[model samples]
Target: MTNTDPDIRRKAEEIIFGMWDTLTEDERKEISEHLTIEEFQKNEYIYKELEIPKCIKWLISGKVKICKSGVTGRDQILRTIVPSEIFSFRAYFANDDYLTSALSFGHSVVASVPMTIIDKLLHTNIQVCRKLIKQLAIELGKADSRTVSLTQKHIRGRLAESLITLKNSYGLEEDGYTLSIYLSREELANMSNMTTSNAIRTLSSFATDKIIAIDGRKIKLINEEELKRISENG
Candidate 1:
């Protein structure tokens, strides 16, 4: 359902404000006027694979995962989205339907503006075009790095890298050790490109080695340096 609440619109505008200094007063006003906000429950699909792009989306709160369905009917996680990050626009730029689906990792709020609006801005704003190009380049670099890690890393290294990726993406709790985001073993397996049992076994091995501590879905890094070494050696 779409939310037209003024407060939500204001919050969305505020998040986008500092992202692009090239946005003119008029462009900002236009974006604010057309923005639509929506709330999604955990595990809900924000957009399905092969769907046409209608809007450029921003994560206002909570987390989202971009994933593609593998041949074996399992989904492989591509990337995780954090608050204030823009998503779902790559397909628009490519002139194709989405290759991967986006799912809410938890209860989430998202803000969107029509792609038509962004296209108009891009045509008239050189700075906006450059900024978007830079963002695309960064995303491409990350994709390349992940591809190498998943294809070449051992089970222990893959699991350790996944944990570190989660930590870097969402950070840790106030305790400074427990990861802020809690993911089930299945989700961890998908992110690491391994079987659920393999993921669990590797995690158990890490705990036995004093590399990490696990409590249900929560994982605390016990020896972050060792974990990094394993990831680097892989």
Candidate 2:
């Protein structure tokens, strides 16, 4: 993580303290002293399972996926981290090493906040502690929902839901039809909790039925209502 753009750091700083107007000048200075910015290349492994969690990461740009590997070497993508979201720090709070891995979806920027700073703030700064608790609860809720959706849904339903999730996360491209994120079929399958072959075949079926249009790694939703129905019925 070596991109040295000064403006990026400023943006990251703004994001961290943007909502904390109640912070005193001294507290803000302490925060500035602890925050560090890092960059990641496409497909870079940001953190791996069993690594000791040293800091919290706030994604400032691009995307990241938190996933775990199965005994058979298959990967299951648990969640995708969007800009302004935090990842890989719950283990730190829980006094355990990371249980999953984080990989860059592409070139990305992350602001590293040390555990010491978070601990200090949690004990001394009531506002920051409450904010952290609220944010973690929200993430836990989303994770539980996704767990149910991925496990109970059929392959087609899961795939449709994944497409819908991506749409909501990144929005549409300028074409107003294509998804903003372009992922390989294998990656899509992992995220959808299906085999790569099944994902490819289901996507082809969707294309045939006019549910979606596929162009290389890009996907365009042609019949979003029908896809939504499938997702709901699942």
Candidate 3:
């Protein structure tokens, strides 16, 4: 991995550690000294499944996908990581290797601080400990909800939920209806826990019903309310 420019590293630290203002000067300095920043190309793997956990990572820019290989070698996308979000700490905390792999969705910049430093902060700062615990709890809740949605929801409902999730995570383009992020049909299927063909068919059905419009990979929501209703009813 190539080292990031100092200016970029400083910017990432400001955004990521802005929430940890409670840390003392020495603690902050220690973190800065140990943090490493690297840039990843589009579709690159930041880390792979079964890799030993080394650091807590922050997505300084671009998007990341957290996924695991399914029984048939298909990938099941668990979540998308947005800019400034912290990740890759769960495995370290659990004393296990990474269960899922992290891949860059586009050209991305990531910053990593050693887990040992995080352990120190957790020991020395009560607030830091509480914040990390709260983050873990929130992630756990989302995982549980997704598990139920994938297992119980029909194909239409699952696809609707995935579209809603993307909109919520990345927002819409300037047109205000088209999704900002363009994902391939295979990626959509992985996220919804369905086959790519099923996702494409369901998306077409939505367009035919006037619930959405498809322009190549760009999906424009025509009836956001109806989509939400389907997701909720499922």
**What tens digits encode model 2's per-residue C-alpha lDDT throughout 59-144?**
99998999999898998998898998877779999999899999999989988878887787778788877888888899899999
lDDT of 1 by residue, 66-126 (tens): 9999999999998999999988998999999999999999999999999999999999999
Residue runs of model 3 more than 4 Å from their true location after superposition: none
* lDDT, model 3: 0.91
- Kindly report which residue stretches of model 2 are placed more than 4 angstroms away from their true locations once superposed: none
Error of 1 at 228 (Å): 0.8
Worst 10 residues of 2 by lDDT: 15-24
Model 2 residue 101 CA deviation (Å) reads: 0.7
TM-score of each: 0.97, 0.96, 0.97
| Alpha-carbon runs more than 4 Å astray in model 1 | none
Tens digit per residue, CA lDDT, model 3, 78-178: 99998888899999999999999999988889999899999988999998889889999999999999999999999889989999999998889999999
lDDT of each: 0.92, 0.88, 0.91
